[model samples]
Target: MSESEQLMVVDEAGQPLYTATRQDVHTQGLWHETFHCFVIDSIKQQVVLQQRADQKKDFPGMLDITAAGHLLAGESVADGVRELEEEIGLVKSFEELHGLGVYQEELRLPGFIDRERIHLFLTDSAKPLTGYSLQTTEVRRLLAFSFAEFARLAEEETTVLTTVEGETIQRNQFVPHPTDYWKTVYAGIKAYCER
Candidate 1:
């Protein structure tokens, strides 16, 4: 799908502003939940990371919080578990994932306000990515980097780092979360791994 095409929005803004899903836009807002994962390999002290697909409409090709995706309108947080399995082929149960917490953020554009609450999780899976499906539509590449490297890269605003892909990070400069969220998560994970 082209990046400009919204899943649930009207092309021509009219009175009362109806959603593309044929619902009252004002009465019904798009509710979203994304799974933000920081797959860790406690044994190796590494974290699994993906370079988002450049074609992605939002945050294209940025170094991001491991595997993440929005929960479809009808999907539940439990379904997010399936997404992790499908996107990265990790055979894990919900109990295996540690609930890091929820992150709510507002991404406002001229006429678009995407207010989202993401369900964050963490897991330890040091397995290699050789047999993993790339899900080209959403993911461009996968590489495991040390948690310290992630902390370093995210500590500084908009920096380039090498992936296990060896691509020299051709696209998407990763920036720190303005609220120090990433750093905090990193510290927590580091401590857990240390234990």
Candidate 2:
């Protein structure tokens, strides 16, 4: 982890209070801003997901959003578009993303406390899975699954299978987030795809 990276610490109301090192932000339980980008291939009715690198400090080896990263202390939400290029090598303009609005999430564990205002965005990428230039240190592989299958899994149905780097994976391999969060994101992306 980069302890020297500066992050904007926010209050409970999501107002920026001050700047702190990334280490302090997590160690002190301070709220911060993060960007989440979900890629949907509307024509194929599939959503792209990424396997976090096994060496990642957080959620290592778990399936996660297509791309995500924290915004630096002086960065604007629009500036976060860089994360997609940096993490997954998908270079996209801010205008290409469909804004899904900001949401707050708080998770507390033994040694981690994350309180984040997530700025979500969606993009329709028709590129082949093999086209992505993976940042090996942050991402392991990319996978795609039918949006409908994901919806069923979100509803607690067992045995959702997805193809990851040519192999099949089960639902247990995914990051276990609240069902409501999954449903909300699914609904949002579905609506966007339909439009």
TM-score of each: 0.72, 0.91
- The top-ranked prediction according to lDDT is 2
- lDDT by candidate, in order shown: 0.62, 0.85
Q: Write the per-residue lDDT of candidate 1 for residues 29-139, one digit (tens) a residue.
A: 454445677788887777777767888766687766667765543556667787677667777788888877777655554555554566778888767777677777777
Score residue 191 of candidate 2 by CA lDDT: 86
What is the clash count of model 1?
A: 0
Residue 177, candidate 1: Cα error in Å is: 4.3
Per-residue CA lDDT of model 2 for 1-195, tens digit only, reads: 487899999876778999999988887788999999998898888889999999998889999899999999889999989889988999999999999888788777778788888898989999988999999999999888888766765677766575533466777788776676677789888889777
Show pairs that collide, candidate 1. Answer: none
